[model samples]
Target: MALHPTLQAVTERIVARSQPSRAAYLAHLDAARVQGVQRTALSCTNLAHGFAAFPANDKLKLREQKKPSIAIISSYNDMLSAHQPFERFPQIIKDAVRQVDAVAQFAGGVPAMCDGVT
Candidate 1:
């Protein structure tokens, strides 16, 4: 994804502050990816009901879906969330986990296992 001009400028400034070493810059980018996981998980909750009435064929179709990019991006998101880092509380993680789990179960998919792009 192309960074917005403002975000790009901000990233440049932050990276410049931690100068010479690129670790800070990479960390910043990874942090953004983690946030994307949380955001997608939340947004996906809204799409959960769509699966409630899925037939067996629909379940098969869902099973064929590739793993969601967010799963990888957020692989650590859940851990971080559990620790309440990045301002995410445990309850937030709990709720998100439950919602995600329900959606997963409904689709006959394993929690955080499917790529979600059928």
Candidate 2:
């Protein structure tokens, strides 16, 4: 079997359009990679400051990096219907991650704007 002509053309166009961005993103990731555990690269004081707000159990889980930690960054705001559903996502994510023996924190929220309303 083969892809339809229209589908193949659309796929080619998307690949061409994304090529530059994909290359730049790969380069950025390579630049960010470094030897050893990335989190341990931070100074103890800095690491403590980062972990200060976490609960005791989470602090212990994170200290040894025994369990994977997930940061749930969201763009949730009640003002936008699209963003509103994200409000419940963190707890849902946390519960799911916990079941997998991983930890998830609602790290932070970013500003969300609905251009149509704005």
**Winning model by TM-score:** 2
Give one digit per residue, the lDDT tens place, for model 2 in 1-118: 9999999999999999999999999987677553323668789998898778777877887887667778899777777776666678888998999889767888887774662433
Give every collision pair in model 2: none
Query: What's the CA RMSD for each of the models?
Result: 15.4, 4.4
Q: How displaced is residue 33 in candidate 1, in Å?
A: 28
lDDT of 1 by residue, 1-118 (tens): 8999999999999978878567877888889766543323434555455444545554444444432222112322333335346334433543464455322231222234333332
TM-score of 2: 0.61
lDDT of each: 0.46, 0.79
